[model samples]
Target: MQDTIRRNGSWLRAAGIVVAAVAVSAGTTLPAAADTDSWSYLTKMQAHEMWKIADGSGVTVAVIDSGVKDGSGWKIDSVLPGVSYIEPPFERPDYVYPPHDDFVGHGTTMTAAIVGDGSSGGPKGLAPGAKVLPIRTSVGTPMAFAVASEAAKGIRYAADNGAKIINLSLGWTPDWPMDKVKPAVEYAQSKGLLIFAAMGNEGEGKNWTNAIAGLPGVIGVGAVDPTGKAMPFSSHGPDTDLTSVGSKVEIRCAENKGWCTGNGGTSFATSLASASAALVWSAHPDWTANQVARVLIQTAGAPTDGSKRSDWVGYGVARPRKVLLDHEGDPGAPDVDPLAAPAAPKTPAPGTDPTAAAAAPRAEAADAESGLSWQWPALGAVAAVGLGLAATVIVKRRRS
Candidate 1:
């Protein structure tokens, strides 16, 4: 049935869906303390930096996953009415039929990672002041053709509805191609939307090229551990644009179950990266998407390749504070893309094969200064303060 649905014209060209299915014989359990510890570190650093930038305050992030649970300790003051794209055979009339009803906690977890305020000692988000627009798709099911169609619809809806950042934590392997998904992504980008996506968690498996992550304009984020090392399970390659703390991040687990302890993957990492962009965007309202992106790439932590970049870490871990504090950084020419080097080739259009195009040889590994790395130290020290005193300490540190 799903294959038949994909045969449709125009829609058949969408990106492939790369879903990672971990064994779930055991029921989902609450995350352990170690997970909470990691989340505290990431969010605490975000707060201490005081990155209330112009990139994301008035911005709206459309979270496309399972539905979000409203009272999950996040400061989500407004949510545009959302719709459910999960094709239904089993129906519940009591449930408002569409938005904010999360049977599976994935979407809610992503939301908290982006805009949560740490009201109940849970994880604090990078962009606490931004708004969220929830769009529910699927949970525990394969990436059905109908679901992909619905996701495209959701992306279009988000763009039409005025969302500035679209965060997609979902992926599938046997799915649509770029031709189908490109229109939707282009539409959103045309509206000045910043699309952020997970690089997939199949690092332990084939570790195939992630679809959305590989898309030309989209920003792909990878996960890093508390110690600043890439997680063994984190997907790698030049496709990754930035890194964020993802290992052992804690979030609301399930109904009445309190918070879970093991929230690790590119799924959560992408959300944090989006929130980081939001903080910078919120602070600099005048900057365009390209300008904002350029700031991030330019100010990111040095890569492993020294002078150049590693295919695994790209420009390296994202550091929003570097952009926030650097009064002299150039946002770059408004028309140029930040990801592309001055001489990098333009992306090929639909029906044009990219592999056939001649490209520059990879540059020699460059040497970079290995001074005190900022992201890890900031995260480690903040987590040490514990969540109970996070707000007070964060405020005091920012002032000082």
Candidate 2:
């Protein structure tokens, strides 16, 4: 059920789970203009502002997706020598097998979205100082049995490695069971590595949740438009844990010589969430994954509808600024899992006032100047072309 289509000068994959090959414009002229107005500010995540507190130094985020290529204006020095789970007979002939060569371009884009260094007009990631561990897997054939097994292996690999956060911008169809990957997810959680997954993009019509997002250990993320509203295509229901800005963002693409604008889904939103965790972890290296996750949920802008939590936007849009800039939200206990089923009752850390943090005004939609804007060097005429493709791949194995 993952058909790819071109619309409004960009490609959109019908499913919201895996990374789809986004087609970009060929040899188009791009202005060197910096996106001073970060799309993250719409939800008050404030990447630029958060950087002032922490650039994710000494932190590594594992991107389990298509291979991450070098020279995409990303901080190549920060990209580690990562592992790949791809085997022979590639599903897509255009794809490069190595963990560093990304012909499919989805992994590269997701990597840049988290840690790109804004070189040569590339997208400046939320945590540019963080290292990205690329764990290559099948992109074109997401639903394949090999893909799930590889993803499970990739999670364990990331856990064994130095990755503090695992970004899963991929998932299978809602009805497809993730029995193959659950143990790996549990293993990652046991190792204190936080896992973030995209809550599929099939919207309400599908009305079903998919793994690894629906899995117990993973934090399921939904997509929100620039106006701080849940995207129509963003999958919803009980599985959603948090939300972030996911549409009309810039990205490095394989199909284009220059950066392309993505009509993002949960894929992009998951990256933002991972980057935010990187920032928090970088600043407080002593904090546990549980603490970081708790603060993020506590500081997040509550659902715009004034609800404690909503399926549409989860606990509301992620506003890391409240934690990084204002130092609000108690980190609570280090061992308590915030997202536990029948969620563990959390008491505020000693001398930390959770009520004061809750009293703060809810985050409102803001324009470019109002959000976290990246100050790139004076690159003349950096053009941001029309909205490029943002394809969402669905991972569903063929059932007899």
Candidate 3:
């Protein structure tokens, strides 16, 4: 049966599912550091200076996206065994769904932005001491319902495992109802997982609302440029809870095909937000999800217009430097959620003892920075999958 994804009540063009990578070669030349750049705002915030205090050690961020590429020079220190929900084309005998295999390259960029080691000339991650749990889902297809369901499964799986933070650098069109994945997000929060999601990239004129970012307790992140202005392309809505430098960012593509630059999107901003949380959570391993979120909100750059929060920049830009370097903000009560989402009763998973003790935070040393150079490629358009008939997806852009 053919799965069709519709947009604006009309069936859009569909394409054949791309083949999953059984094994990818790692011989492509990486981009040079001198030729590429990172988030200029992060540099101004002195993220490197803050790293001395905490580099996201003892934290695990679940990256639920198209897929993440695992290999040398990828800046990933450790990638845990992850799950995949991508259906094979025709159930071929040679089909193998590798969770870490990234064909779209979007997930790879998101991962590198969070924990990339900066060894292969790629951008240094904000949380270099953290581990990544890759949760691969269906993308590039037209079945929005299937895609959303897979993403929900990924969230639950990450929460049950050891993910302290979840990065959802993906979203659907404005009209796509988020009910399918909303419960899973709540379940993750109930389990003490902090989720950061993109607010979409429809810009000011066509600024569409993304409910995933607006979900209670989910940190909805938007994009801002160097001058503390919301990017014209950044989605704006009541759910917008935070902002990050989303313009002119650097990223590492799969297949060793060097680095790419001139990229901007809520997806990248979400990754940065996740990394910021990791840094705080690692420094204070015992803090509950709510406390960490409260601190992040309290320490974030406030709106330049003197407002507490806004539809465009949320609580201003995410600034971990204050929390790490200056020790600003209060973690607040551990039991209270900062985003104001009511806590759901925790339910034990099947076959698991409810009395089992929660696992202790992992203790890992931050990796040393490497001198290998890398570059960022121009953002390119790729196929995005989602559910419902009234939604449309913004093409992932590449600036070459």
The most accurate candidate by TM-score is 3
> How much is the lDDT of residue 170 in candidate 1?
64
Worst 10 residues of 1 by lDDT: 391-400
1-400 in candidate 3: lDDT tens per residue?
2221223112112321121121122123324454444545457768888888898889999999767777623444567778888765453534556887765556777778888776655566778788889998765434434567788899999999999999987766544455668789889989999988787665433455466765667788777765566765566656677887776666543333456554447777788889999998988999999888888888878776576676677777787878888899898789876767432333556776422212211111111011101111112112442111124322211111
lDDT per residue (tens digit) for residues 305-349 in model 1 = 474444445566677766675553578787666665532433546
TM-score of 2: 0.75
Deviation from native of the Cα of residue 337 in model 2, angstroms: 1.2
lDDT (C-alpha) at residue 367 in model 2: 24
TM-score of each: 0.73, 0.75, 0.76
Following a full C-alpha superposition, what root-mean-square deviation does model 2 have from the true structure? 11.3
Superior candidate under TM-score, 1 versus 2: 2
Off by over 4 Å in 2: 1-44, 90-96, 141-145, 174-177, 254-257, 341-400
Steric collisions counted per model: 30, 10, 29
**CA shift at 124, candidate 3, in angstroms?**
0.8
Local accuracy of candidate 2 as per-residue lDDT tens digits, 229-306:
776656665567778777666654334245655544677788888988898899899999988988988877676556
User: lDDT of each prediction vs. the true structure?
Assistant: 0.57, 0.64, 0.64
